[model samples]
Target: MADRSGNNKKKVNQGATLKKVFERLGKYRIFLIFSILLATVSVALTLYIPKLTGHAVDFIVSRGNVDFPGVLRVMVQIGICTLVTALAQWLMNVCNNKMTYQIVRDIRNEAFHKIEILPLKYIDGHAYGEVVSRVIADVDQFSDGLLMGFTQLFTGVATILGTFCFMLSVNVKITVVVVLITPLSFFVANFIAKRTFSMFKIQSETRGEQTGLIDEMIGNQKVVQVFGRGEDVTERFDEINERLNRASLRATFFSSITNPSTRFINSLVYTGVGITGAFAVVRGSLTVGQLSSFLSYANQYTKPFNEISGVVTEFQNAIACAQRVFELIEEEPQIPEPEQAVVLKDIDGNVKIEDVSFSYVPEQKLIEDFNLDVKPGQKIAIVGPTGCGKTTLINLLMRFYDVTGGQIKVENIDIREVTRKSLRAGYGMVLQDTWLKTGTIRENITMGRPDATEEEIIEAAKASHIHSYISRLPKGYDTWITEDGGGLSQGQKQLLCIARVMLCRPPMLILDEATSSIDTRTELKIQQAFAKLMEGRTTFIVAHRLSTIREADVILVMKDGKVIEQGNHESLLEQGGFYRHLYESQFAH
Candidate 1:
């Protein structure tokens, strides 16, 4: 009963996936209809050519008594059929190519759009390489399968039907022979397809795992080498690669069995038709030319069974791949903003976190009943040890993940009641992990405000103390960088990110260890720039280095997901509690 239930569920899922694929295809229904019509025309002409050949054969009744004119006229008809079939087949292929690629394009676009809106929790929980595989590798595999189905499956089925009709017109016995043996081919293909689907699905998953491992290792090669983990990484990779190899081999073995197995069955059908047709001719019930036509029809009728078997095998893999792509496209996105969500404008940045509770996992308590309130334009610094919810607080402020409990209000309005875009747009953030796209330095700086004037761009760069470095580059502001900001030091990358936020000068600022990478001298200069940037604007500075937040209006010390103490730097030092212990530990004599 359990096995039966599982099978039923699998069938339902497959049916739903097929429905999605067809719905995408239905958008190009006109092209699909045209392709089918052309396939029919092509197969009809192709099937007719065999009969014309048989007629040309019959016209040679005797060697010298042959009606040459009759044979020539039949040959002319055969030529016309061949030419028309080729033309129709060509046009059908063109239509199929256009429709198949368009559907793939739509699926890719939806998947990418879904990724963009996916909640931070979902992205954080999944490997980057696995998601990338769905978009790139799995989509490409589906494309190949769809193309094969369009190019071969349509015409193959049409030829089978046309040949059966043509054969029935010539002789009934041969048609019966071909029809009787065709099911064996289907039985073999169906049995293999059932097994191969699960195996191919396994193959795709393992391939994703392998891709994720490679991406993880390559992205952090420096860390891996520093930690002397090359051998361990290679061992892990080999294990995954072996699993992928095993799964691929099993799937290919089953799928490969389909084509030849069906061909063997088809060969038997052909032999049966030839043997039965010969006896009919001996019985004076059929002419040689008619028997010849029936034999050609028999071969044609069984040929599609072989071709369709291969198509089924490939289509199974495609379905598995499409399932992954669709899964990504259907992934739950970020919680939707309220229908009539307020759009924040000219924000005064008073913020209150009221009785907030949250956790990455539901069962584990991370932040519980957390609360804070700040006046507008207060430079509040958050200092904490690692994983004590400093970053989680930042995430909540950015609405990357919604709190599980309680409310966070900005300017006396619930943050959830405002559009996320508007809420996020009011703040400038520079994290320790700097990101720069592959573009000119000017482009990276002006990303938040693209219409910033050249003078403004230069000013921001100068303020962040990066203008001198940029001026030294060969192309200055126009110098192109790689995606990972290649050829740039960690300090330089951080400065570029700082310049980015400095240019925006948003109503609020979030600096999550923003100056952690730069030397102390550069840090002091950037801090001065940040001081100017923070003037009359609310700022939340998260830092492990206690020295930097000394000038902040308020300092909130946190530990174990709760604030332990809050005061100005001098008062917090006077308390001589956990806050003083942390400060003393860092700046101890």
Candidate 2:
């Protein structure tokens, strides 16, 4: 059974969505008005041409007096009218294209900026390629459809209305028939449009999913090749690609049939009008000139009905894409900034977390009543089994997420009291999963501090033990890395990230499994440098390897989001609790 309620909701949204599209264009309403006026005049001129031709025919042949002057005069007027009509139509199209692109550009920019402000949770929940498709592919489709829709809209209306009024003045009886059949075009267009709108929406969504799959498979191509699971990946992609293909085909099939179906109905109306007017001419109720003009007006009247059906079909597709674009634009942004926020400044880096609680979802608490305190410069290690909220703790500290309960303070001020940018600026971070954009090595290192001198950059690199590797490269620091730092080993990428942190030289630091990718020898070589980096700064190290945190002044043993133990390595070993068991498991082997 058809979903009556669903259909009703869709109908309501359809009206609202198209209204939104025009509202965006309404920013340039003056241009739209000029385009409409030009289109109306163009259609009027074209409609009047047939009447002049019929007059010339009557003057030359029907009167049997070869009035060449009258015929030539009518011909000249028709010639001038057609030329002017064509020119006006050209200018109208130019305006339509301009308006279509300007609106699309604004919409694209809005969607992109929205992505930047959106919360990390929102981005994490959706696939990257899916978001990109809406920004790029969907926006492009909306623009193309609007260009066609706007170009045809005014001309279609003016042609239909002008032809009807002219035909009515000529013969009301035939004009009545034309009016009665116009509903056929509307009914057909509306029916197909309603049916196709849902299909187009599904198609847009499926295309995004398919794009996401390709992005995922290609991004992990190395893993796929090592496991030799290319066929499996391709099979999964094929399933999504096939679904997209079916949805697109259905949307296109339904919309494609509208124009021809409307045309068939329009042809029937034209035939009936021609036959009735012929009989009227023979009976002397209409003159031959007027009968000829009625035939042409019959065609003109039906043409817009046909064009309107096609434009409606295209506009329906555009509306589907526009709805998706608007959804992203309208989504609530991340946590709102405080109206009277303080900027974190010149910090000694004393940190305190008291009764802090957090949860990814409301029902299942991830971290509950967590607390920690650190002096201005202290080395702290966070160790736990996987999924024990170590990463979650770092995320909360960075303000990527906010604590659900309690407060985290930096230098006695609640972190929430300060601007996120300035609060984050107090810390430098290096993670296991390295991020290096497509740029030269020097550029990547200096990304955190763009104004650092070359010597300072090299010093940071040497501190990370990556300077020797850079010196050996073909272009040293000037060599370009591909997307995601392709062509570099994982260890090299991590070293570059460390170099980035060294240059940042923030008052606080977080190293989350930061050296996991580097070899033991290389890591040992940088141990002193790491110590130096930690000097005079509050630091947090999250590590699975117990060897790295032996010298930490305080070691936090986390289990299920709560700190289960806190002490120096020797004290934790003496306690023989969870932390001792974990440390022994690694070194005892």
Q: Please, what are the lDDT tens digits per residue for candidate 2 over residues 87-186? A: 9999998888888899999999999999999989989999998999999989988998888888887899999889988898889998998888778889
Taking every candidate in turn, the Cα RMSD to the unseen true structure, in Å, is: 1.0, 1.9
- Expressed as tens digits, the lDDT of each residue in 286-350 for candidate 1 is 88999888888888888888888898889889999999999999998998887999999979989
- CA lDDT, every model vs. true structure: 0.91, 0.90
RMSD of model 2 against the true structure: 1.9
The clash count for each model shown is 0, 0
| Reference-based TM-score, model 1 | 0.99
Using TM-score as the measure, the top candidate is 1
Clash pairs (backbone) in predicted model 1: none
Steric clash pairs (candidate 2): none
Top-lDDT candidate index? 1
